[model samples]
Target chain A: MQTEEEFRDFILNGHLYYIPHVTIDCAIFGYHAQQLKLLLIKHRNIDNWSLPGGYIKRAEKLLDAANRNIKDRTGIDNLFLQQFKTFGDPDRIQFDKFDKKKWLEDTGLPSWEGNWLINQTISVGFYAITDFSKTRLQTDFITEACAWFDINNLPPLEYDHDEMVQEAMHTMRLHLYHYPIGLNMLPEKFTLSEIHALYETLLGKKLDVSNFPKKLLALRLLKKLDEKRSIGAHRSPHLYSFDKEMYALALKEGLVLS
Target chain B: MQTEEEFRDFILNGHLYYIPHVTIDCAIFGYHAQQLKLLLIKHRNIDNWSLPGGYIKRAEKLLDAANRNIKDRTGIDNLFLQQFKTFGDPDRIQFDKFDKKKWLEDTGLPSWEGNWLINQTISVGFYAITDFSKTRLQTDFITEACAWFDINNLPPLEYDHDEMVQEAMHTMRLHLYHYPIGLNMLPEKFTLSEIHALYETLLGKKLDVSNFPKKLLALRLLKKLDEKRSIGAHRSPHLYSFDKEMYALALKEGLVLS
Candidate 1:
């Protein structure tokens, strides 16, 4: 845990050496229990939530900054991540509504630090998919709470983050249609129906059950296991896992699903 | 036309109020003579060419900057432009080789403007499709020459611009797969073979000639016009034009072409 003074110095002096007027915000989407969720963090005293984000170091690659932010927030590494868009609207920071000076003063920080916080910032949006079961959320000094919220039922977000999340979801849905994206969110082994549920959750619509399986099987990207998923008083669906080599080939060739 | 001294003031003082350390580069892809070409400009006394680009104004939207740049270079307005990627590699500006000081000295610019030129800049890449026949290429004070080069054979470019052009081409190809993108580049009326040739030029591969027409017609986005295109010693082909309303619907539902 960092003291207030230490935190203030880190934000003011330490971050001054970084590339100014630019930031990276990540919409880390996770799937678990057939629900799509987004990881969000709230500042110590702020009521509104925001995406896990950080500034780009002066020498750091943009993608590396996104990867570092995800690892810092979730303690998870080697996740599936991609830069979806860059938001550079002049009013993106919404400084009119966000009183950076007052917030810095209330937090007992020097007035000079407010300059760094109030500047116009252009943010690159990155979307990451991780297995929800594997992530252990952690909060840093600036963040008081970090948790996952169901994508369909998100809390009020800060500074155009709601729009960012919607864009991320839209990009992911488009990606899912052409690529095998559920592999990162699904377990090592899962039933076909479970994968179908994941797609439905991301697409925000139910797919035809009979046609879905046939379309997926045609790609030949899934390997059937001897095991089966047994649910109480229901038919047991055969377990399956990604055929890694074939899946890679299918992704390259593109498995288009209507 | 701006004198060297006036241009120095514009770079050093006039642009100081705008956003620093960021720029927008547009790969204006135009189709003419059945070939896809990219618009490029060369600075006065500079041997190498680059995409028609400009720095972002502090109050300007990123998209607006791209639009402004396109209008300034081509004298074309309301273009079909979309930002495909943001190139933020720390060494993107390549100050080591670019030598802003030397360039300014050679161009008779003040050394102070070199300071602004040497600073790190992250560029947003936008790809625009336009009717080549409709454009009037205009060269500004900074640009000595402006013209289009076929995508297959581009001249040596400056500051990672070759990579930017490649990325733009890749993005446009992927976009062409899902959307009716040739509307802006093709003529008001074109033969089926001409449209097919346009796609082949963009995709860098020949698609099935027989099935291509059937697939495109099934979407009901193209209407057979009463006109026909004639070539000497060849059979005349019936001309077709896009059904605007149906084309928009197809774009929304996605006209997926393999």
Candidate 2:
């Protein structure tokens, strides 16, 4: 594809205008159907999948590169993004195992471009939270397909992306212990049960149904709205929306929801 | 110095056997005299001070590199260390401001070494916590002196190291809110006021004298020892030490010290 050629040209001479040996990989996480999911892409003509990622421009901030990768792939903007960790293992590219010549032939890219891709890279890992239903996913020339896979059932990923995902999950779980991350995943207004469900999905464990709501309420980060939601054959539970001021206070004061 | 030549050779030919374009900068924090301090080293003939740091070996783990940096500088091992952030600005080395030719002339290195020194580099930031009384600081061939400066008063630093220190302080403060970082800085047995003073120093503000002790007690991380420390004119306060089991539980369950 012409787009692939343009990208190859960008990559071959990217060091002239961008930071060489550095890239940003985003572990874009979404919550849906009581399961945590990750946005991943399969490279064109390659049997492996990888996290949505791209190189950083010479003058761009690291976080901006992550945002650009997410926007280009998912068409989502202003998502909750945080830099969790940086992966700098020297053999991260694994050029010994990768068939760069075959890739160059399959993609019709110059050998220099293949060599560039095989060079040492230090990837900054960012984890983003977005509503799954709201994103419009699109694959670029480099990718054959874009899809969401359950975090619990991820496919074989490329490079050290699997480790990146695991680190992101560990960081998210640690963050959730003291921060109100459920606000980023849940609807604007919902019952305590819904928020608890989101936590269970992210933590991948069963929480005590009776004590969870009380612990959340103690933080005073949610405001009980007058409206209620009626579930099938169950009591109508009161809806609650995040109290922005209280949430800010909790962030400053630090809260333990677990 | 012969050490300088050896280090220069290591830098010039390091890429063939080590990871290139990536380095580590450590913000080694020590607590003493009811104040927080940072370990800094003044580079020989450079006039400017910098964080004690070094490059990662090709076959070394990123964290291992950080540990090696700490050990090489302070002659301390097994300190509490964590990676906080990474600085990947393309202009990080500031070659335009640095006199590469003069450095080569002074250090008696070849032109290739000068070019390698002027190349762009991405630095991974690691913050380490240690007891001030324990470390035996030493200066290397690159540094004329190594000493601890109060966090409130730091000398003019090289590159973006000032920002790295600020970021590390911010991260350590945040870490202190939910974790028992005092364990690393405090003595084996200390009074409540000593621990409170440590928090006040790290947080850079005076805490409520009465409420701080109660808040720490609620976490149950510290056990009241059978001994007591008598003040000059005040009542003797009970001595306390970290309860290993409860400390582990607090780490897992998440404790909010604030």
Candidate 3:
């Protein structure tokens, strides 16, 4: 929302336009220079940091809602986004510490009872992958701050977001074994070791140098280029690149990279 | 609901007890004797068939809701279930073809506008695997008939259920490659061919029989018995049972049978 009036209207009658008790929260993992990061934001009314998310518009597709949430919070668009899981435990969101009195005061409401925003919600979790160095963070009226944090050293997240991150990481890692990623995260033409390091960083584990690349090669998802790139004396390695057609096919039909 | 009054209360005041705009739908696939089937239900208010599903209660976990939906529709409980995906397209459910006038006439309602039951809901899709020959069918108040249909020759499903089944099958098949299944679908002691045909049936394709069993055996999810089972005068094949501990661990940690 751009103005206080708009925000007030959204708070009072948002269910008219947005689906109440249903939301889309995203775990945006950013990678660049062998470093992994996550995008988090602080809400204007909340004391804790949370994942980037928003209510899905009544007419919007969930994927579109996810893309809009990513853009609204991160100033980034068109990152590869995937639905990881949906979280709907009754205790997933803890509201005991929320400043209900202050919220009612700010919204100019008489009581918190039966408020549209106070209803129990189940959030559909989606994970997005992007290169952090390629984008800038943007915040809206409801956002206090938006930035990327190192995935390894994240601050204590609010509500069920910590669990959401763990679930997202697990699904994303599992997806790496079947689907072809790194189309946007890596250079068009790269070496096997570059892609190897990409996998190690994304998977958060070291892979055997010789065996892992061969597995990827056996899937025929990559192409061997005759061109070579030299890093040192007598140490030129053959440049390789992802076969775009095969990569797309793998994304649909899936492959077993193990 | 067992009574019409209870069903009416559910229709009118269900939002108070159930989360609005969110639901759980299940694609229960049954496998037995080299045959694959999908459990589908014909709702009393609709002519077309749908997957077994219902609203998630405000105080209930999603998995519990899934289990309840399966039991309410299938008369079976505790089958292995997994959440595959959530469907949230605004057009997923088509009210255009619904018999709204008959619905209101039966409900004794003046109009259907602003009704809680008419809200656009996003369904969490889950797929369950079971042995079809072991369980009997049951029907709830809203359900007209429930039965297992051959997966390959299913009738035209209602709303977006055809898409739901397709997505469920895709995810389930992918899971079979990475996880161990067949705890309840197969006998405790079975030959390699039995499991091989089970996979072939669920996958809807003929696999290379010799090589596929080797891949499954390599996962160490199976235990070969010292004795063999004789089916013919001279042919005796070794029987194998699942390594329950490893199978359970694989369900949690996942395994790459591929």
Better-scoring candidate (TM-score), 2 or 3:
3
**How would you encode candidate 1's per-residue C-alpha lDDT over B68-179 as one tens digit per residue?**
8778766767777877888889888787778777777777777654376567878889998876777888876677888988887899999889889888876777777678
Error of 1 at A205 (Å): 2.5
Order of models, best lDDT first: 3, 1, 2
DockQ of each: 0.52, 0.37, 0.79
Worst 10 residues of 2 chain A by lDDT: A110-119
Candidate number with the higher TM-score (1 or 3): 3
Per-residue CA lDDT of candidate 3, range B1-258, in tens? 545566778777887899888999999998989889999999776668889898999899999999987887778887778889999999888777765545755645444667787778899999989988999999866677998899989999988999999999988988887788788888889999999999888888889979988887788888999989989999999999999999999999887776
RMSD of 3: 2.2
Could you give candidate 1's per-residue lDDT for residues A29-54 as a string of tens digits? 88877877889999866789999887
User: What is the Å distance of residue A122 in model 2 from its true position?
Assistant: 2.2
Off by over 4 Å in 2: A44-48, A91-108, A112-114, A177-200, A203-258, B45-47, B91-114, B205-220, B223-239, B243-258
Share of reference contacts kept by candidate 2:
0.36
Q: Candidate 3, which segments miss by more than 4 Å at Cα? A: A2-5, A45-47, A99-112, B99-101, B104-111
Return the top candidate by TM-score. Answer: 3
Best by DockQ: 3
Interface RMSD of each: 1.9, 3.0, 0.8
